[model samples]
Target: MNTPLNLAALVLALSAALTSAPALAHGEAHAGAQAQEVVKEQKPWGIAGDADQVDRTIEVSMTDQMRFIPDRIEVKLGETIRFVHRNQGRVLHEFVLGTKQDLDEHAAMMVKFPGMEHDEPYMAHVGPGKREEIVWTFNRAGEFDFACLIAGHYQAGMVGKISVSPTN
Candidate 1:
């Protein structure tokens, strides 16, 4: 029973258990852990803004039609925006902000793991007839994307754009 083959099997089992511990502790599974961890770092789109320093507040409404009312938003670079999200639909929705590439990757992950839960400063999850808000400082000047990455939502055209213009 103490053969080399048995020892190798035991080592592999232990290695998998050890590696999965952290992911379970964080309530994230596999690739989901990587996605949430990436959100904690600074993104090229911008960083989380302080609520007290909010330059303006924009109200966004989500509906069952798989759309965000006023899907286009423009802001000046370095402006802090408090985005108030209202879910007017009969189902759940989420607003996630990131670069187009990041959004695309995250959306794909969402398709694979529909139950994955991630709470970042750039994301607001709202249930039916619920309200949520996220404050973000657009310090970069470029075109970014915001979307509802709940399984099929993103693919249903539930996406928005944010244009950050360089400050004069």
Candidate 2:
């Protein structure tokens, strides 16, 4: 009698344990699905890059109010960037990538050009509703600043930061 009772108790415990396994797995699967949905929604405005690619592309649009839609950018060291800049502003605009010191130096040089130097590879003075593009590579990891060289533009918060991380 004692032996039969002990066997029955063991069987019951094993069955309960087996039933709970599926429930735990189902809960994990549900959580994973929710995380995937969030990633898909935020991907368009997010910075994406491939370490193996020769050039990574970033699209930036400028408005008359002096703002970049995505004000921050991220990249890995040794990655090349292809920047597509569009001017949706009433006045001219530019997208220049360099250090704070480099921007200051170049900004001074821009004054030498009459009105604004609208035609340069690293600089652009695109008029309203116009678009321009530039490709550059980052050989090292550091904080880089980008801005419009037009007078009073940088002072009006037309600046942004780029973060580069160490390559894997």
Candidate 3:
């Protein structure tokens, strides 16, 4: 029944969560710090959105199989979206929004620095049985990507797509 594979996956998940323990311990302050660090750079995806400005909310779920339900999503340019992520599996997961290149670069970084802590308006890290939300405005018209860059998760194909329709 692939017990060894299952055990390996569990170990990876626990390790991922443990690595973020220090940042999580400080609550939102550390999260805020991470978000600020990311914000200092130009966002290749979209800008952070105000909660009151969200045009709609999308519900997404993550599983231990390394997948996001409804992996493809569409939105209009200039529209703000609130992503509601639920971690239904017995592992840690994160929702990070970016362009394909942005995601790829970040994935590579995750492999090098698994315990690296940083956040942005477009990222939400969730532990098992928990939920998190991120609001973002799709100011540009292009295809973006979302992924879980937790150690082996991204390599296991835990990713999603976002399409922003062009506006005149």
For each candidate in the order shown, give its overall lDDT on alpha carbons: 0.84, 0.64, 0.82
Q: Return the lDDT, model 2, position 12.
A: 97
Ranked candidates (TM-score, high to low) = 3, 1, 2
Off by over 4 Å in 2: 1-54, 108-120
Q: Considering only N, C-alpha and C atoms within 3 Å, which residue pairs clash in candidate 1?
A: none
lDDT of 1 by residue, 1-168 (tens): 679999999999999998876533112222233244324456799998877999999999999999999899999999999999999999988898998899999999988887775567788887789787778899889999999988889999999999999988
What's the candidate order when arranged by decreasing lDDT?
1, 3, 2
- What TM-score goes with each of the models? 0.76, 0.61, 0.77
Clashing pairs in 3: none
- Between candidates 1 and 3, the one scoring higher on lDDT is 1
Q: How accurate is candidate 2 locally (lDDT)?
A: 0.64
Per-residue lDDT of model 2, residues 44-118, tens digit only: 112322334546678899987888867799988767777778777777777877678878886776556535313
Q: Candidate 1 or 2, higher lDDT?
A: 1
For residue 136, give model 1's deviation from the true position in Å: 0.4
Clashes of 2: 0
The sequence of per-residue lDDT tens digits that candidate 3 reaches over residues 42-104 is 476778887788899999999999999989999999998988999899988888888788889
The most accurate candidate by lDDT is 1
